[model samples]
Target: MMRTSLDQGTSDVSDQQGGVRTRTRAAIDAPHLRTDRWWLAPAATAAGLLAFIVYSTWRAFANADYYAAPYVSPFYSPCLAENCDAMRAGPNWDLFGGWWGISPAIIILIFPLGFRLTCYYYRKAYYRGFWASPPACAVAEPHKKYTGETRFPLVLQNIHRYFFYAAIVVAGILTYDTVLAFRDEHYEWGHMGLGTLVFLVNIVLIWAYTISCHSCRHIVGGKLKHFSRHPVRYRMWQWVGKLNARHMLLAWASLVSVALADFYVYLVASGAFDDPRLF
Candidate 1:
């Protein structure tokens, strides 16, 4: 119970159920009383995310050094233009024709980018890192009023479910790319190199991140009234739930792995160094 006195600028607060103890709270007008540095997490998050954005945007536009004989950058996988003659990873997926002169990665990256942009985790991350909406706990946001995702650009987050479907297709393509990475520079099967190991790790992290998505969890587990009736879905849902718990960790791991994988291919394709054969 709180009894406020306008004249005294204090409140008589009962600290116990039976009013056995009473304490007065003299209001402090400061925004928050936190004494420690609370901005470090958001600052680091902004730095990491911003660094990735700069690197990815630059690489997406570069368009060169994204493919070597048997390895292709994840950014340019499923390259879909006639110009992708040497760069093409799998079968001739010249879906976009030769008229498209820009980077093939431009066509391929949109789906996965969309999936991550609208991801529930990324949204929360950028919301604090970039926007600083109440940046940390007990902190007051700068805005005078709060208008959530009810408006224009933010409202587009509702399409996350659609992006989830596109991500599944992209993951499948990357998986195919990872399989191709097992070959040597001469395209011989049963060969493994450092690049092959990189590709394998990248693909595993990507799948882990995708399968651990909240949308995946809902798709496999939600909308079921009786778990006893559907044994298969129940089992799958249990599996997804386990991964979902580590979704954030997987998200960061996959993000770094993809960039590193692409960088490795770039180094090899650019003739900076040959992908060292491991086996």
Candidate 2:
């Protein structure tokens, strides 16, 4: 009986040690799982954004209205001239295709997709927005350190200074286009082109995006200086910092507005929508 009792006690001790080992392993592995879950929100947001883009593009292509019919629609009235019926009668309605051998409409359509997928603000937003895999979530597993992707190309997004210059130029060109939209075939300002409104909105959206960028804020503020040494500089930085707070909001809205602007222009060029003139 004594021998049996000793053996039983030994077995119980071994079982307890095994249970402790199992628990230790589990505790080590739990963090990795939590870190992974943090990524779910951003991934979901990206998927949804992609879906809308695809649907909108497909709709733009499939619609028969994309090919302007007999009469210029009410939407084009801003540029319509006396006896302007001749411009709308033809089969060729694609302004971008006519101006550039490559369709500007298609270029505008695809530009945002590339920018958004690689945008710094978007990366941060996704990192924080996702519940399972937030940006700061680190794996607890020592052996399984999450050395996934280096944010090199992403960090290069700091080149928004260069992009700001480009955006300014583009905005100017768009503004010019807006002016052109008011001119009839006779080259006089008549009414309003729906395309003009769309183009103007696009300019505003791009401005919002460029201005709200973190890099732009830094450039404007002049990086990290002590307020005592440079109060004016510090104040400027503070103001920009305030705007930067809404950078994500500006980014997403800019993305949407630019896309819609292109879509509206495409519709007008395709003849899906009419621009009627009242004046």
Question: lDDT per residue, candidate 1, 30-140, as tens digits?
Answer: 445577899898898889999999999999989889888788888987888877747434634889998999888899899999999998888888888888776888765
lDDT of each: 0.83, 0.50
The TM-score obtained by model 2 is: 0.57
TM-score of each candidate? 0.88, 0.57
Query: After TM-score superposition, what is the CA distance of residue 69 in candidate 1 from its true location, in Å?
Result: 1.4
Highest TM-score against the true fold, candidate: 1
Model 2 off-target regions past 4 Å?
Answer: 1-40, 52-118, 125-160, 184-186, 224-236
| Model 2 global lDDT (CA atoms, 0 to 1) | 0.50
Worst lDDT run of 10 residues, candidate 1, spans 15-24
Candidate 1 lDDT at 150 equals 94
lDDT, residue 269, candidate 1:
89
